[model samples]
Target: MNWRFNICFISFMFLFLLGLSNVFLGIYFCLNNIIYFLEWEIVTLNSMNIIMTLLFDWMSLIFMGFVLFISSMVILYSHNYMEGDVNLVRFILLVLMFVLSMMLLIISPNMISILLGWDGLGLISYLLVIYYQNFKSYSAGMLTVLSNRLGDVAFLLSIAWMLNYGSWNYVFFINFMGNTMESQIIAFLMIFAAMTKSAQIPFSSWLPAAMAAPTPVSALVHSSTLVTAGVYLMIRFNVLIMSTDLSKYLLLVGGMTMFMSGVGANFEYDLKKIIALSTLSQLGLMMSILSMGLPNLAFFHLLTHALFKALLFMCAGVIIHNMLDCQDIRYMGGLVHQLPLTASFFNTSNLALCGFPFLAGFYSKDLILEMCLVSNLNFVSFLFYFVSTGFTACYTARLIYYTMSGDLNMVSCSSVTDESWFMLKGMMGMLFMAVVGGSMLSWVLFPSPLMVCLPFELKTLALSVSVLGAAIGYSMAHTNYNDSLLSMHNILISFFLGSMWFMPYISTRGVYIYPMKIGTNLLKSFDQGWCEGMGGQGMYEALKNFSKTNQSYQNNFLKIYLTFFVLWIILMLLIF
Candidate 1:
């Protein structure tokens, strides 16, 4: 076991080196705005050709570096979190496999190559999601895999659609797709695929369900790798997707997802699920902004969000580890007095997630809000953006208050000590990035200043939302709502909010129950009754009867043959 841990450390170091090389590659590409295209013909059969293509731009290089960096940090974090588990080695390998899948997806330029990575992501994610081998984990893994399979199918269909152009390299077709209906169809399939990966609107149930996995997995898969794959793909396809009707549809779905998840987070009590819901909400914001024709802003937020969200999950892991695996926020309080350092990391990441000024999240989130304000958006879209940002602040403030600020609620407060340095080691690795990632990405990704002139009130809108959300969140958490008249009066309303708008029910029963019932009926009727009775049972009966008749004739064959011979001789003599 000690040697296995060492092997894990070696793997992390190797990944760190890879991350550094990618960073250098990103810097070089950024400096020159160079596009390095690599292609190798793998197969040539008549007119059909299959080639492996890699596209290296600032996007892939920078994103790949971030993915590798975060993965290394997660593996380090898992050392303490997964201690004493016999399967630690396997867990580390799974994390590495997931990282490899993400890398393959990032570097691929051709649709065929992309599917390999995409399916790899889906497969590895399912394995990771069910790593615990519990009923809860199994159910979550099923939902997660089934949801992702839809995207895989969509990608395959898109690949088939792209065959009309005689190439699977989508990079070659971006500029040629504008105003073309065929491209729109392809983009439509691609958008649906992205939506599943990003967990937008109708396909969002699996994101929260995936919290059943280990916390490190939650950090890696939900925050960094799997969820963002869709956004990255959309960023690549922006030329074909932007300003189309499908983009508008994306705008609507993303907005709803963001708002719904935010409102859901406010009522959530499970520490990990709250964070999961927040990830879902932020994903919505990214999708919505991307739909508004700012893929760069979306990509920027994706990178920064990954940093803090991963850090946040690691902090949650520490608390859960010390709390004897209790995830309910109501069971935790005043952890700042007990575990000061972990709480600091936790609070810092939470604030970053809320887009605190000068931190990592602010750089991208502020720009996104400003961009949203200046864009020609409808009233509803504007409301969703501003309100959802406020909701983010509100839920985060509530989380911090419940988990870190209130009275010590644990029965054995002394037992909750942050003595695990390995956990802290991982948190420390990403702390710097969580603080400054947004600023660094903003400067490097957008070297030229964004020119925007806005009214004073418009410029301050995002600030107002943050302040208002914080104030509301604090009041809601601090005040004794049970004693207030509105508490009892709005019981039903509170139940609705707390149930996450019935998404679990709708996604599980509302969507699947009928189809599953129909499937069951079909299996019983067609497979068991008609097919088995007609093809299996009926054929067996006919064969058995034929065999019985042949045996009986053979038994009496001697006597029957003599009678037939005598009759034949008599008939021949009469004819002569």
Candidate 2:
């Protein structure tokens, strides 16, 4: 099949066109203050109304536009990324299905429909994460799916919890019954669901593990759709989250998530994983902001982060592609000299991630920092906010130093040029967005600029932290990796921080080991030993012994009977 007619090309064309239209429509809807709730009443029984609802407002429409736009680019990237693979068409289909699930999630306001979309995302993400079809992919996919499945269960529970509210369309009930006990329970469950889906503290290990998928899938999943689902869900229920007491939990978890992931990224050597950790940190930021009752700000950050993060992943893909599947940053150096365009895009996205002024990330991140600075946040939370900011810059600088400026760390004869025209084309769209998408989104998201009045020290705190982080990162970049290991304890510290405080262990081995061992013991003591001896085997042995006694009696039946009769006769004669 030719490029134009092939599935990849066709899907990209279709999604890109649809994205443009939706974006325009979203803008129109926003400007005109229009909200459309398209509901199909599937069934009506007494007080029950089963409705398949589609909510088309500025939020959904714009989110849909972003998702579709990013998806199109990712598919285009995959066109070249998966070129020689035999199952290219299948990969394209899977990607389309993944986007479809995201669209479903974005549009639906009804719990039932939301559950369908929610489960679809979880199931399809599993498929996509395991697309490489290896042991590592299998493990990562399982972790990812199981992690998301927690959210699915939470969604189901929330749906069931809302059953008493007589309508699955939560948009209506949220304002009316938001403070009720049932709504609180449902909201807490939704928060739990969001946490799992978003990879909050305990659920975070899966985000890095999910890097087992293809780069295109990573660019799509991590950047725009799957991980962001929780943030979007919370945004929809922002009213409820703000009103309820659950927001405190969110505050703590989001702060911890931000801090831990930032630390983890600094110690990480894997290029994709460092980016994944950054994604985790951003998710934490969104969650915390949402908890602060600034859902709009949280959403603003989400959109901007999506743009640059997608570009970052695409640039990483180009580098990884050129490196012949080597993903370690330590093994890479002087890439800027060999691949200038890719490096430039990489640097742009990295700087944006660091919240460089006028870039996509700066608008949202700076606002978030100012809000935290001005908000009545506790001391620990305030520390977490600024410290994590420093770590963000630290990791970004370290990553840049490692990949762009160090001595050549690759094979002497290996090629490292960005020769893939299609890959560059895929990145071009996002690169444009990464540069200007922030200001445009900030203007659209906040009709009026948020006013922040702060003293000099407080205002410059974020900048100071970032610069200090950069200096440390640069100095550390020049040091040998082995020299940092002063002792075994330091190694442990590095490992713990690098491994997300050993959360992957907690999520995987820590979670399953005890249960598995207990299960095996249960099988041995009951199913194999005592219960078997008393149940099936014991019953068989008793039956065998009983049958042997019966057989012996049958073999001596006439003699035994005659002897008993003679004894009875003799006894009777004596009595007479």
Candidate 3:
């Protein structure tokens, strides 16, 4: 059997089939009263025990099934995307390892076991982000790893703190005894950890930078698995921390991230970066809703968003591949005529992301909006939610126009054919889900109807934003807004909004400058000067001087030594 047509494709189909079975099983278990719990004792010393506990509920099963489904699709897509790579086998193995880690994370109710999965995700993601072996990949890998390490440290500390409770199993204790101060601290640490993993707010720079990786990896990382892990963690811990100040903080951060990334997408030229930012925005939306005491809704959005977003990235991959590796949307237009199927997928996924009616994003996002309207939220939160919704529509419309609706901009000789059957097959597999995932998840997850009583104004906010955004996006793409660039005032305004309110600076340079200066001082004053002088160089000089003194004394003479010994003996005899 050919290597390209072997383990990778086989694993893809197998996992995909397994995922479908798990989904049915999850629905059955959810409808029934069966909750599967598995555990094994790994180590025990007196009262100190480390046990691996697995919790299989509707949530875990469904989530794991979705993860596997997406992973399998990504692997299938990689068959064509990663062709001719010398390390294709390694890439497939790494992807499988990532899927396994995600499964471990989903099933484990124990913090220690969760760490195994969590660290695996971080490590594998870093490796994947640097798979291209370029300087950009290396930098992105470092940033991604360092950002995720913040979460790792938080998890480790939380585990240490949980040891005081005599067990690492947080699922049980968090439900029963989580009202204590120590538990709150642990909850805070877990929130911090989740934020890093999910690319929330300040820890968000890594998500966009991680687009340096392969597109299949992007589809997997940005859509289904890595980014959603944080949201999943929050959903799991929602009961304990829902009403805490940390949850409120998450609401704030999540909302900000949503708005910032949405705005950033409008300005991004790189096709992949724009899509990546949109993913970030949706993640923010999920995090914000989860922070609002609705983890089920968040999880629902997670699954649905995974479906469409993965499709979106896969569509982007098709375009990029066809365009001879060029990822700039500015250079891409009138592609719909050439690549009809790919364009249809791209447009459908973008519309889904914008929460068009009946699409995968609409069910969850619409409910989230309605829920927010009915909830007792403040003005800022409401504004953030609605405005972010509008921004989402605006940027997605802009994206569609730039990539699918304009005149052809590339060289005339270039030919883009939708001939990659594997790519189309992978995308087609997801197209059905993208169309119906929202409704299916909505029906299954929320068996009872949501009682949302909103006023006319609140009820129509989403529709109004969608229309307005579409209009604005069409106008911007068709017209020439030279005043924004030529005028000093508009230039500053455009710069501010276009640069995502200087988030890149605030997250990178703003964070690095003071620490780097401090590090330089420490290197000069302590590491090289004081610490080295007093530790390594000073000790070496003192030891050398002492050895010289000992050598000189030994060389002085055996005769002198004998005379001193005789004198000492005489003095001893007189004393006696």
Candidate 4:
């Protein structure tokens, strides 16, 4: 009867139903050779039309199962994490809404239904981010909404373009786009939209900002639903993106984003921000692989990343909750002794994240690098993958060092304890998957025939190089380099502090600067010269007198109207 109990009950029921639905659909799709199921019926003249179509293919089922699994974990974790929070009911409601929307997104066979679910997820995520209504959370929520809306605009445009060109369904678009120029354009626009939704490149700032949300929201957004949506979009349009010039562009953008965000992750101090940046970087890697026409590889990485990143974030949450909400890694060190399980889980997840040998991240990330080597864009792709791997190792190592192995002198253990059994169980389950999923995936997803015929030699060499790079990075982090001089006044530090004010000017100089300067001068003139010339406070009085003088003329339009009407009548009579 209590609010929290009610939320728990509802959440459990929803996930249970969703899991059951996925199972039924999967069985139906596989056993009955059913290509499509129409749940809603309609009529057009004498013809019967379907209103809702469900296409349950392998890809949709895989992603749907993942969504359901992760949603269930989040719900269980929230039961403990949000125990005493006043908005627990609202939080659970939003979680259910998000899960339902994601399920709908994966199952929807038409663009209209897909967009409906997509927008619903976005809206609910925004609301969840600002659930507490604090200033910072409000800003985060606004940023999330604004970024997603920009992506939604691209989606709408693409849909309209598709409709105008006579392709209203996913299957038709896939077939049509494979043989047309407009298809490439639409594909490019869709990728652009996906990038924004997944927080890739220029739009990536919003994901880090979204850390203002509760930890459960972070897990949902980063691990399972929101960020993965872009990957899904890429997968949905896999045939189109692969067969067009858009593929080349996707490869380039995705590769660059992977490398760039990897570098950014190295510079972050907040625990959540580090993980958030890593998520973006991993998304980039997945996108790059997808662009290379390897949707299966991308999906594999998506699954692995979800498992480890969720584990890492939840572990970090346990630490934060124990430390009275402190998130800065600078203030956290040597928590292993007090929170052994949290530390262990964090380490395991971080190992998987760094692409260590035989871990989930290793298989997925190595496959991505291998695909890069074999892709047509191999030269550029290899370089991006190499650089990104190095940077990923650096930041991931940094996170581990800062959190678990650092000097404990600065950290206080005033009220620290291990996480609840439920949280620990959830994390351990993910950790188990992170450790073993890679091998299972390598067997299931990688084609054995292709693996044998292709140059396994090159892939082996690539994997060796990636592993070696990670090792070098791990060793570098292990050795404490005493470079106080370098640390005291690094150029990057100076640039970062000063750039806050100067970068805007530099960036705006081309077109923005001129307009901004002109506007500023005009404002100055209005304040200093115009106001003075108009006698400051007496300007209103002068305006009032002028308005009074004009009022009679403005109001008394009867004479002018009559004269014009009479002239018009005379002219008409003369013409007749």
Candidate 5:
């Protein structure tokens, strides 16, 4: 309570004000179209000026505002969520450190200085992921850390590549040298890094695995902080990435990631994991759209998605908390009856996610989809985009069907209430943002609404897919319909989709199986057979025999001593 009263309360107040001011600054910066880049020379060696640089622009300020505002709400919510935990202070501290790292990253324009925040993020996120102090949390933390380390290596490589240009600040060189071979190489590396952090395909397994963290951290990580870092980086690097051939490949990866994660969520039963997969799906949408050379559109979607998704996670926390920590949707039917307020927030956030007309997700998500339709993408990319959009709606509807409208599945004695003041207050605030954040961001980020000219069919396609997906999702909630689905020949396809193309097997176990088998074989033939025999067991046997022989000799030490005494006397006389 003291920890809550002191650190949580103080941090919540400070961060809220900072976030509000950042929102204002962001709006002003956007209106004025001003970018202020400041550099501080740390040291000089030869011709290279080691410098730390900060970029103050609309994008960074707005992103900071959303990140900080969400983080503050999360911290305030945790006041009630983690009230009984003994390590509440430690949790709050980790969260504060996480926010600080995020701030450093948001402002940093130099690759070298950005690593401080990048590595800090990776380290602190690992600490937070393992915050529950259990084996599952540890294992998930390992996967999360190792996957992120690949991004670290990519960042390091890009940093080294940038060294050839005599400075670490990429902003100076990006616009002019964008089409050059060297810049393309750096863009490739940065794209790789962004993919891992943002949880695009082949690197998406960790997103679901990371659900092992507490809900509050999940709210921050999935919504506005950790997963979005990559998209932010790519947005910064868009000038360079779009000039090269890499954007095409990025488009394919993002589309597939979206389809993959969306299909996976419909198969998931764990409530939190389902939400996590949704986050992954939205991340793919952002990445795919950004890859199309629309960084501004991508940023718009990023901010709008953050608001609703954070509220979505908060509503989930309330449900899970009141249900005595049970996370399975199968155990949580008719929630709207028992916890109407939570259901209201949950359904609203979920609808916003589905891009329900003019809600937070609609303004941005609709624009992105519409922009995609207008672009000359290939049919495969086109299919992936729309199909993924449909699946997004499909999963959203399925979650609502399972949790909000069914018969009560909880125990009779269970007390489900949304009376937690702190948690409710946080949700209320995010709900407001989730409802209006889209229009606000769309207005600020754009001087006027983007006018996309499209045929009636094309313009309405997004809404159409959402409706069709919703119908399919609701049908999925019926057991009889599900059995019919399972009976179909598409069962294997469904299984593959549900298993994330078997990524847990491919990405997680697939990575270690070969090395593990090789290590096992090496242990038998090399360590156990040769090295152990010659180095350990062989030496032990040799030492044991020598000791035994010496012991036998020592048994006769008394007689040998007398013989030595006689021999000594005879030798002494001979020598004299």
Candidate 6:
């Protein structure tokens, strides 16, 4: 790699250490009340609120730690993964840039700082997605960027609303939100932003499109950072949402998204896309729990999802590399003997993801389900959770079976090996953690009394149900049973895809067709007749006609003088 890559990576590592230190110190500052920001300032104070004060809570610390840990792994994984690629150096630089932005995002003190980091992460992610510059990758990157920008606009508008209403800092915003109807509106707007960022129902298409990125990019961005932005935003504003009427709809949206995406995963053939859709579904479940005032559960799931999902994507990448770029799981089969290590890592991660007993996903997912059962939310919410869990099991099982357990018809025995040591080391570390960390963190996050409130007497009961679901799914996969039984209801699928395609139109026009047409015509006339008639057409025509009208004039004294005179007038007005 180039020196620039080395410098950027080293800088990111240094920044990460600084950020971690801030988190630890911030906790101390909060406990001690060392310093605090009462309001906005023209210049930040020295004894200004301790930087730790910004992210002093358990949620922030947990997320920041995950970001730091995953980013470090991605950087190390990239070192070997991108070894001979031409853009290797630029890729590393962009990765560092991405990590730094995420770190800033996790610890940002005010709306402005959070937004700056948010947009920065989005920008670098776009660049990384398009790094290879293939046609499909470029298209995918463009789509992802456009969708993220839509979310950013909502975030910016919410910030504007918060500031206008006299809440300019995190603490103040939370308190103010608790006092007014404006809080409900703000919560809705924030949820809108999160939905788009997290790829919920109507906004989820971009995620599968994003499979065009490199495997590491997919793992780092989709699995860990980009998609999780929405969840982080929700967690950050949990205090507000928990107290508002808007909290009531969270279960509705989150439940529907989880069910819908889980169903959609069954239709996918690409291994990574299947995992991507599942990630969205799982995140939707976490959002549902958060909506029910279970931020702790959401936070826990986010951690586990990051670990196992990253491992799944990385393993998928290794498989694709071995299979000479084939990503269709149908083309893969019976590689367990040849790729024992890969199979072991992949299976372990998949089992964890399916929420097997004692695995990371089991602990996190069970908490969310338990929250749903006991939450004041209606029975429909519980139904959604139950159905979604089964779907999750089916799709996850299909992923494991299709990739690992079938006949050897398409298996290649050319002695293709697992990825490099760095890659394997990262995957193994995650696998080991996924296997053991769930029970440990559960003990820490949920003490005895809370565990007892869960619906099942034995935690093993939930695990048994998840295992049974997986077994049924595996049987279907092995028997080549058609999954059309689990496909989304045709009418609903049609409506959802149709609505996604026309959302921009629907937003500009009303949803009713006649009104929509009238609105469209009005907009067109305003653009072509009113706005263009004023000077737009003239300016456009002038630019187009300039080459023909005055080859010499375009480069001559008269044109130059005219431009200079206009600039001089504008500058004079500004000066005055």
Backbone clashes under 3 angstroms, per model: 0, 0, 0, 0, 0, 1
- Give me the displacement of residue 414 in model 1, in angstroms: 5.9
Q: State which candidate, 1 or 2, has the greater TM-score.
A: 2
TM-score of each: 0.92, 0.94, 0.91, 0.82, 0.90, 0.79
lDDT tens readout by residue for model 1, 328-361: 9988988999999999999999989888999999
- Give residue 537's lDDT in candidate 4 (0 to 100): 56
Q: Give me candidate 5's TM-score against the actual structure.
A: 0.90
Off by over 4 Å in 1: 41-50, 412-414, 480-489, 542-576
State the lDDT at 198 in candidate 1. Answer: 87
Off by over 4 Å in 6: 1-53, 408-415, 447-449, 453-461, 481-576
Candidates sorted on TM-score, descending:
2, 1, 3, 5, 4, 6
What does candidate 5 score in Cα RMSD to the true structure?
5.0
In candidate 2, residue 57 scores what lDDT? 97
Q: How accurate is candidate 1 locally (lDDT)?
A: 0.88
Per-residue alpha-carbon lDDT of candidate 6 for residues 1-576, written as tens digits (9 for 90 to 100): 466457545754764575467546544554455654333345556775423325445555556666666666666666667776876767876877787787667766577778878899789878877887898888778777877888899888888888766655665558555747678777888899888888776677677777887888888886568888889889878988888877768778888888777776766677887888788788888788888887767878988888888888888887887777788888887768667888888888888887776788888887666656666767788768877787778878887788777555455655467647777876776677678767766665665536446534534445666666677778767665345543345656654542344443443333334675888898888876778866789678878787766766666687677987999999999999
Error of 6 at 240 (Å): 1.1
Candidate 5 — which residues are off by over 4 angstroms? 41-50, 479-491, 520-576
Span of ten consecutive residues with least summed lDDT in model 3:
480-489
Model 2 Cα lDDT, one tens digit per residue, 472-571: 8777766645465332458878888888998999888877657789999999998999988999999999999999988887897888889889999999
* Model 2: pairs clashing at backbone N, Cα or C within 3 Å: none
Q: What is the lDDT of residue 397 in candidate 5?
A: 88
Ranking 1 against 6 by lDDT, winner: 1
Model 2 residue 391 lDDT? 91
What is the per-residue lDDT of model 3 for residues 12-99, given as tens digits with 9 covering 90 to 100?
A: 9899998998888888888785798887888999998666789999989888888888888888888888886889999999999988
Model 4, 94-150: lDDT tens per residue? 888898898888888788888998899889989988987899898778778877888
